[model samples]
Target: MKIITLIRGTIRELAAKATLYVLAGISTLMLLAAALAVGADSTPDGKTITFFGKQASPPVTNEMLADLAGKLEAGFAGGLFLGIVVFGVFGTAGVIPDALEKGTVDLYLSKPIARWQLLLGKYFGSVAVIFLNIIYFIGGLWLIVGLKVGVWNGRFLLSALLLTYVFASLYSVVTFFGVLSRNMAIAIIAGILYLLLVAGPLDSRQAGLYLISENGIYRGILDGLFYIFPQIPAMESGAMHIIAGEHAEAAPYAQSFLSSGGILALSAWILHKKDF
Candidate 1:
């Protein structure tokens, strides 16, 4: 019951944000366009290009349609991922810090919930928002692709799971910063920096750095950072595997799960000891 209350409260706070609504509106528009395109029988051959019932040249085969669907799914994945990191981080990064604000902290502490429960509840609730949003976006695309192409790609739906895991992993970092700093700007900046360093070149460039850096301490530090941060590249590869209908190894997913769990545990511990 305590966790439910926190979930409801966090969801309500997210819904109150303008960013959520704007993003939702954009997703809805895309879904609408996709729906329209699905039903328009522009050509009996299924060869013509379509846009909201508008027909274009170039006859396409079922194979072509399947390939198009796959490519579209991949492109959507890339865009949705960027949106998830940007809008998702900025949208909910403040939930923990806001809860910890002066008067707000007092009220929550007075409640019957345990500190860990409250923190975990909020964490799960934020992830829930992302889950629902992804469902809406990907669900629409899945249906549109299936209906238009006459091929239901089960892989598309499965990609949602991998993508959600990715978002949740990143959100754990955002939550940690929010809990530690209790400042929205600091939390947001930290989350962005984390992505730029851990997910960006720093992850891939480590190998070359190790080869060039003669200093043992510098090499050690690079190796340490590499192992410390969640293996985002591995998770991303897993996502691609889902899209491509290939078997993905469990190691990357497992690594990301353990890392995310570790971060959440650390956040909960910090919140437990923290005083308003």
Candidate 2:
């Protein structure tokens, strides 16, 4: 079987499902809020909304763009991760076991192809669906940021790339577990727990992005749990740093793009050696 054909078929199967309701709602809210802030200063009309110490008609500048981008990135990632960590519980819930239970896995297994190709084809197909959705998600974010500032950040585009990579990393692990149980529910639960309860704690350890706000208790848990979830994408932090302008003094999006490629390669390797 052609890998491209198989990958395309799986993605088409998933595309027919109505997954846009969530994206539509999220886009609407983000756009509305961003527009209000950018064009109207948070007050839709004649209402006087406070802007800290800044005057009513604040001057637009790159510094202001950086500040807004940081806040937006923080909120976007926080909410996006929260949604993934929760809804991922049912995202690919029945992919594996259902197919295997229905004997579909056997059918695929019977094909005159290598196990690696079969596993890789399935992984790529599922990942393709994920990739499209994440791109649309980033589009929503950029539309809002652009409308608000009358200028789009190069950082937003770069972050979009990283966000997609992170999604792939999280879902790749989920796919691995899904293959193990051939059960959808189990795989989703495994992924969610890893992303939420495991990944966060693991990275904020002894060598974490230590700071004052996070506190020691949080840092200790973060450090201890870093390696437990190997699928944790380093791009998650790198994206945030870029939007916050923290990377201004360092290499330009160097860390994020490199991390993205690393996660993709890691996921591909995992799928290549996978039994299913």
Best by TM-score: 1
Scanning candidate 1 in windows of ten residues, the lowest lDDT window is 37-46
| Superposition TM-score, candidate 2 onto the true structure | 0.69
Clashing pairs in 2: 93-184, 96-182, 97-182, 97-183, 201-222, 202-225, 202-226, 203-226, 204-223, 205-223
TM-scores of the candidates are 0.86, 0.69
lDDT of 1 by residue, 15-130 (tens): 88898777778788878877776532436666654666666435677667666566667777777888888888888888889988999989988988888888888888888888
Q: List candidate 1 stretches off by more than 4 Å.
A: 33-64, 206-221
What would the per-residue lDDT of candidate 2 be over residues 1-276, giving only the tens digit for each residue? 567766876767555555434644565675565555643243333222123334444444555645655566556765665554454335444544454454676686677765556555666676666556556666666776566544466676666666666666666567667656667778887787876666654454434445644687766655544533453545566667675656632332344335434544554465456554
